[model samples]
Target: MNLRQLEILAAVVRTHSTIAAAQDLGMSQPAVSNSIKSAEASLGFLLFERVNNRLIPTPEAQVLLADAEHLFLMRDAVMQTASYLKAGRKGSIRVAATAELSESLMPQLISRFLQNHLGVDVSLETHRLDTVLNYVETGVSDIGFAMEPYPRPTLDQTPLATLDMVCAFSAKSELGRLQFVTPVDIDQMPMLKAGSGSRINKLIEEAFQKSRVAFNPSVDVRFMNVASYCVEQGVGVAIIDELTASCRPHTAMRTLPFRPRVQITLAAVSSNSRPQQRLVKSLVKYAREEISQRLRQVSKERSLKGT
Candidate 1:
């Protein structure tokens, strides 16, 4: 019936006498007798038979003993698993990041995390901004990096970084010579859309609306990789995240600072129902440090240009 009762039963059978079982179990004879009596009352079966003042276990007692021992063993196994997780031992982490974050930041952050927790497996996916948000919302992934900032009421969003869209063109392009382009110039340069449904797109639209700058997109593409490929091929001028500018810097493409441009907010999103994350949260912490480093570079460059 109860664990103590089952243990008492086991001790009684092994010791072969109630008096001996009580001494071996560190309990009084009356205590062991009460346990066995309570257990039989609960299960409606006598677990032991008295033969010449010795306790002989019934058939049902043998079966109950097996189950009782198994219960304690399984409980120990569960406790060990919890200990492993708590100590940051073997397990897999599932993360989905925006294409922009994936390019420059995730590689180094993940590399460092992997070095320490070698036994922890990381499953990383590159996702579109919109896709990243949906994945986090639906619990498809444990953590998500996204710039497709829309309100997710159920999800807790932590804004990690804010980046500006920089112009990308062939090294030979006219605007690449200038350190930075003004809003008026941004209007004149051929626009290459970074696709629809992104916080960057909305910011661009709002910036243009405020300045009343009329510009037409020369090319439209999804996936930052593909858009950068278009820039590499000299398709047209494009505005992209700074990560795109940093990527493939020697690939016959040039980066130009754009003004009144879109701002991309990189956020880490996870569901409210998510378990108290240990490793994944540590990754997010590292990512924040990386963002700080990047922003410092951006600020330094901007200050030097002004001076």
Candidate 2:
């Protein structure tokens, strides 16, 4: 029988009379009686019996009523779950990020997201830049954060932030005294470089070449954090993303704006094969807002410092 018929039956069982059930359900007595009769006819069983001018529930009626109550509960739960999903308040967000964003930004971003959406669960995976793109393309992750150029043809890209590259040097070094470091300033110095063929390394080399200076590195490393550590220990000056260079607290190193303004664009990648879910879209929006606020604050600080 239909939900309306089941509801009328339940109402009659609860109120013990067709007139009372109709009143409780805001329907006419004949309508309620007709619905109950229709339900009983569909099941080919008598749901109630008349004894001493009063209606008494049959054994079948009790069983059907119990099952009807369970159905109502299940319907309510389904509606609530749908509401949560529509509002982006409950779901799991799987994210993959490159080393730079994963180490420096994702932790804080995810923490803030968890705080705001307490019903949502987040899974964060860290990988190299290329692997992060793979995760997004293969649907292993819902979203990905990485540096450009975004090479995955199967993924849609959204630019998040563009960060200027900065040179990090030991606080005690003479070069640290300069407000900004020119490519020529570090030409002959022992340099700690990013891995060969990396995007950042190519940018650094290109900047030096544009200034008519030779590019040489005393040591080569696979990650920016390692290069930053080398700079902190006075191994040599290293040019790295602003996020990685700024992660250290009360550091023994100083960061100077590198000229002539090498920059990298950070972007969010999602699969093009499927429509984005509400939760994934909300996460990407929030991440973009946070990154924009951070970049604005950095710009303000730089403007004040005349750097």
Clashes of each: 0, 0
Candidate topping lDDT: 2
Per-residue accuracy of model 2 over 1-307 as CA lDDT, tens digit each: 8777878888887878999999999999999888878888889999999888667889998988776665664455466557658887657777898777777788778877777788887878888877677667666677898877446678898888888999888888788668899988887888888766877788888899899988888898877877888887879888998878766562788888999889988888999898998878888888888788777777787788777
Residue pairs of candidate 2 with colliding backbone atoms: none
TM-scores vs. true structure, each candidate: 0.64, 0.68
Worst 10-residue lDDT window for candidate 1 reads 72-81
Over 76-153, each residue of candidate 1 has an lDDT whose tens digit, in order, gives: 445555766888867767788877668767887788788777788787878776667666665556788776467777
Instruction: Give the Cα error of residue 153 in candidate 1, in Å.
Output: 1.2
What residue pairs clash in candidate 1, if any at all? none
In model 2, how large is the Cα lDDT of residue 162? 87
Q: Tally clashing residue pairs in candidate 2.
A: 0
For TM-score, the strongest prediction is 2
Give per-residue lDDT, candidate 1, residue 304.
Answer: 70
Error of 1 at 86 (Å): 17
